[model samples]
Target: MLATPPDFDVLIVGAGISGIGMAAHLEMMCPNRSYGIVERRADIGGTWDLFKYPGIRSDSDMHTLGFVFEPWKHEKSIADGPAILDYLNRIADERGIRDHIRFGHKVVLADFRPDEARWHVTVELEDGERKLLTANFLYLGSGYYDYDDPYDAGFDFSEFEGQVIHPQFWPEDLDYTGKKVVVVGSGATAVTIVPSMAEKAAHVTMLQRTPTWMFSRPARDAIANFLRKILPEKVAYAITRFKNIRMQDFTFKTARDKPQKVKDALHKRISKTMGNDFDLKDFTPPYNPWEQRLCLVPDDDLFESIKAKKASVVTGHIDKFEAGGVRLKSGELLEANIIVTATGLSLAIAGKIDLRMAGEPVKFDERFYYKGVMFSNLPNLAVVFGYLNASWTLRADINSEFVCRVLNQMEANGSDLATPVLTPEAEAQLEEDDLFDFSSGYIQRGKHIMPKSATAYPWRLNQEYLYDRKVMRKGDILDGVLTFTKAGANAQSPDEQLEAAE
Candidate 1:
């Protein structure tokens, strides 16, 4: 008897930047391979759609963050949530990818059957109904963080009478005009909310336990705007993308190589922006820049708000929540009519889906990341995790392209499965390294759950884009590490096939 075939060649899990990019690549690269995207939410844009907070915008400029194939024609390189969503929507519509997506479907569990060389996925619909779908390959594009729950810092608000909010679940109808607001934390969200809320609020106070390193750049890229006017759209976008990628790489390298110099540069920039109001204690963090991602303040908005006395920063530990506001450990009380917890995100592995291999739960922390795309010993599965130091879409684009190549190679070679096989001998010889070196709260908290990494290439999820681009784009698929085989009784490892060929 013959085994059952999969419904689709590839089942992409998410409608976010990563999934959209993958679908676009498959359309161009592997046109014959049928695929479907199952988005948990009812909309197309993932993060952009979920986050409805005021002044929601892209931390990274759109040139590099935008898809490589798609040219971002927006005037502002650093665009807002709606603009980014529009860009993504346009891509889905123009490329005819929207027809392939099934919104309101959440992937709950996935089990790879080695015998059939297919993945049996269990999807839960929004109406609480469940259905089973099978696919030849599974691609997890459901971003890094938890969508259902943000990280809870365990602040007791029992004593406080004011409305407490988390930025992740911003209330759409809530009004803050003429109200005194307090935003907690010093991360990107807090910095963004502080300035944005200050614009309408009577006064905004940014309360943080520690200061985060911040750098301000114009919201609009003048060079990109200038180029768009003179040069062709594609050519101009390509140039700007190249420039931004190099600049991002250089800045990250400088921060790593010369910490003190980067620190001095950041201090000087912030000092100049804040002028006499700038205090060394409030702006200077104990750690170096890029250790934890630097907060990008567009057009000195945060500083301007502070200068205008519309917003203020308080550096202290929250002792407890009083009726009026948060009381500090330093015996100072910060008053507010509303409190916004700009606390960081909680990381989830494979979108918190129950991933199993041969009906057994797969332990991600025990597995190794292979070529930063797939995991060791995992067959026909690819994950889209972006760069930490650079724009996320950089990694997403490369990953999508690489996965398409793998699918194409499988077709050409008559192989049903491709797994990065790590034999016992090879695994024993490998040296383990921390998957991520950053000291950010979320990264550190979730380090134990992330896949393991080795010091060498192809065994680790690399942080450098320049090196990754060459290897992932041009490297051979049959590199001896990835074992390709057929299904059932005809199955044979790549080594055995090679021996037979010789």
Candidate 2:
């Protein structure tokens, strides 16, 4: 049965950071317009609220990960899960965004009608009832990962008698205390889970398919703390943000330019910290640094766990699962009371929502990205993607500003819809192979969904903060691909014409 539909000017899917941020921008720009945010979970904070794995925290620094309009005031630069969730909840409550969010409402499908210039969205309520809503604009912020379970390759777990758990679907009641635990995968989740579980488990073994580059640093920023006491809070935040951004920029540049030196330095640091307790080959990555994400070790916790003989890392492929254990391809068997498959997530384009325009299917795989925002020849649509080299919020902020500029211009020019039309030559130049090279699951699934770029920065990815600000925020919005349609001569206003020229 279908329930009555709700009408709104804008309907945003997912109440995560991105969705919430988008709603905030809309409210600020068009206060008179009615807007609603839909979330599947009973609460907000999307991933943060769902993921309850031990040692769950942000992989990046909190200062950069946070929203630009709302600065994270916590003293810890690298915040844990609870702190991050608290920050997100605070932002929603303080901004009065909680009321606008309809929790337990999960959008299943969305279709765009070109004639109406609106999206018909169907959502499934908690009570197993379906409903439809129409909105002028549709924003997807569901993110790339599958929240239900870790997308492990088909391994029959039914045969294994031991308890099996995926970090994405962690059970709160199950106790791991005094139990031999095995955590699989080499990504951030595996790195976090092993150390935390080591504290309670009888023994924790990290089984990885490949080694990843890992670096350890202090989580607390002592200098920033001192500055907070000496200077104003805003000034202190600015100083900390600048220092972290510059340092990250320098580190990424140096690693990219002088690969061998950085790799050697990293190898030496890890070897020195571990001594003769563990083999160096098992911990070192085969590729150069920054080829994949470098794992951050807060306060040397992972290394300390290794030194304490509480954790051990094994590098090999899994053959199959045996009763009460995991069998490695190397003919070695690891017995465990519990298995934690921290494998990885599955990625989906536009949150895997089906998109249509003018009764024709808009294949994301066949489209070329324009400035990493809109697909070629796509109308009334834009995607918010962040920089690979810099903070995700840095690019998202610019994207929001760009959206606002486009909307303001369209209203002033009497334009009913604006679309990006790429030339044939431009479309032909795009290569599919360049789109995905990383080992991460999100990048793999995104290969067919995102734009392929040749270089890392300024072209494929512009990480320079100032450069992006000038090009994306203040640059000509109507320059190349954008095409606007006038509603009617009498419908056009003076403000519309002036905005079009600007």
Candidate 3:
């Protein structure tokens, strides 16, 4: 008797940018493959739908953040939450990707059974029903942070009588109109909320322990808008995407090579916006630029709000939370009727899903990252962890396309399993490198959960988007690092075996 085949050739987790990008690639590149997407939420947009906080917008430009297969037709490159959700929705519907999605189903655990060359997946439906499914390949696009929990900075809000809010779980019925609001933190979330809340709140104060590096740019992309009017949308998008990618790479490289130069440039620009006496200490960070992600203030909104006296900045360590507001260690009390904790996220590996290999739980920290796409020694599995310095979708697009190439090659060679196997000698000689060099609180706290990285190529995430794009797209698959095999067969490079036979 013959055995039953797996339900799908590819099982994708999450319906976000990365997941959708993977499915799209499979359709265009490997048309013969069967796939299914499992999203925990009922909606299509993942982060876009989850984050409904006021003035929530893209921190990066849309041209590079958007998928390569689709064009971001909107006038504003720094788009808001709803606009981005709409873009995702249109892409899903236009390509019939939505039809393949299994909404309201959450993947609880995935165990890859190497003997059968398939993954035995355990999923929970919306109604608390557990179902088992099998797939030939497992693709995880489930972002880096925990969806249910935000980072608890362990603030004492018990004594404060006013409403305290976390931006991640912002209530829809929240009413801060004409209320005195104090937003805590100086990261991207706090920077976004202070100016937005200042519009309606009687006064909004940004209370921070330390300052963050920030710069301003116009929300609308004038050049992209101009090109769209004359050229086809795909052509315009291609040109704009290329230009923005180059610009992003240039800025990051310049900041890393000449930190003082970048710092001076930022200081001069901020002084022009906020004036010389506006307290440079509030915007100056202790670390150099690109060490932590820079906060992008669109159209100088945050500075303008501060200049208009609608909002203010207070930098000090919080001693405790009082009835009125937070009391600083400097013995000063900031008054507020509403306190917003725009603290950072609580990071997780592989969406906090339980990953295993043949019943043995996978300790991600022990494994090395392989080409930023798959984990070393893990077969038939791939993940979409995007670039930290550049746009997330840039790496997502490249990773999705690369995975498809691997799948197509596997089929051509009649191989059911593919793993990036490092020899014992290679592993011993590998130099350990930090997976992410970010000093942000979340990255620092979550470093223990991330996979190990090496100093060499194909063994690290390499945060350099341009270099990764070139190598990932055009590099040889049979690099001898990735070994392919049929079930119950000896592992070897398929091309090598073919040459030996010839």
Candidate 4:
């Protein structure tokens, strides 16, 4: 029998924003390297397409959230779900990138063969057929949320006669117009729906156990609009992108450094906006800002809705679900015709794919991450997970460019494998904690299975975007931290080969 060639040089496990961006970057920098995107969903947009809840939009503005290579031409900085999906589709279609995507391929197994320096991937198609693909490198651009299972919040939905809806699987014909609505949770999803539903619903109430940090900004970027009219399109985008990034970074840094000052400033804004009638305590979060992702309200829509008497906020524990509505622990009942559980997402790591090396199973929990991208001692793979504190695409963009640099470096050095080996000293100094460092329910719920971050650089989950950009931009492939092994190095064991990466 004739020998067969590997499917592609690089296998990207998602066709979402990061995957598409990865494809674009690969084509731009390493044209000779062949790659294909395998997406489980039939469509292009990942989360944007997956979610159909009313009032769904981005918490982060489009200037920094948009891809570095592409300019978001839309007027709204906080665009709706459909607009974002459309933007993603437009990039894929216009760039002719859709041709390389293999839809309906769900990766179930990814095993690294150290002997051949390749990955043997097992994919399951929608039609129930299983197939195998081989590649020199694997890139996980698949977003982290679990599609099949959203967080349940442990509510007895059977007791409630009212309509209970999860944001991920919003019903097509469930009309909430002229109905009393209560949105559960105080995160981005709940806030987004509270304002949008307030426009149609008779009255909407946001129910939360604790308050969340909220910030308001105009939906449209005045400077960006003015710049577009005067400056070149790309130039305007660059300026706007830089300005937003710097401002966002400053706010986050200030919060971390002088939390009490930031807290006071936030109280001032809330007090000024809501006036004396509204209780400011209901808006004040207990924890310091940036401990969890802050909620963004565009153009003060949520506040305006509250001011117009279209919506209200209720902070209490749910005693139980009654036939009429949710009963609070204080013996008060809030009547609601529709209950929206904007609860939270169920976070899963590595897409539940059983990753192995040389037939030996790999346990992610036992290892610390390498530069927040590659797993410790895992060879030839990188997972792109962005910062919760910043626009996800910021890290994704830098990650794609970083991958391209690694591939080019490998080709130049005639190397076939690159792995992040935990040195004896690094291992001794390793500190095991939650990878996210977040207090959100989703992060708390999934911390056990998540990987750990070390106490030092090239191992810690660097949450700061500007710092990460500078670090990853250096493209130090042989920084003595990440290891690379040569092709057909049979004389050495896998452990020895990994240490010989440089």
The CA lDDT of each predicted structure is 0.91, 0.74, 0.90, 0.87
Could you tell me which residue pairs clash in candidate 3?
Answer: none
Give per-model CA RMSD.
1.7, 4.3, 2.0, 2.2
Clashing pairs in 4: 484-501
lDDT of 1 by residue, 198-261 (tens): 9899999999889999998998999999999999999999999999999999999999999999
Please provide, for model 2 over 160-252, each residue's C-alpha lDDT reduced to its tens digit, 9 standing for 90 to 100.
Answer: 889999899889898999998889888889889999999988889999888988887778888888888999887877777778878888887
TM-score of 2: 0.89
- TM-score list, all predictions: 0.97, 0.89, 0.97, 0.96
Give the higher-lDDT candidate: 2 or 4. Answer: 4
- After the best TM-score superposition of candidate 1, give how far the Cα of residue 318 lies from its true spot, in angstroms: 0.7
Worst 10 residues of 4 by lDDT: 490-499
Which candidate should be chosen as best, given lDDT against the real structure?
Answer: 1
Better of 3 and 4 by TM-score: 3
Task: Please count the clashing residue pairs in each candidate, in the order shown.
Answer: 0, 2, 0, 1
Write one digit per residue (lDDT tens) for candidate 4, span 1-502. 1145568889998888889989988988999998999999998888887888888899999998899999999999888888888888998988878999999999999998876778999999999999999999999998887888999888987788889999999997988989999999999999999989999999999999999988888899999999999999999999999999999899999999999898888777766677867687778888999888889888889999999999999899999999989999999899999999999999888878888988888888877877778888788998888888899999889999988888998888667787777767758876664577788999899888878787678887788899888888875778886766664554454446535544
For model 1, the stretches where C-alpha displacement exceeds 4 angstroms are: 1-4, 490-502
lDDT of 4 at 82: 86
Residue 352, candidate 4: C-alpha displacement in angstroms: 1.7
Superposed by TM-score, candidate 2 places the C-alpha of residue 176 at a distance from the truth, in angstroms, of 0.3
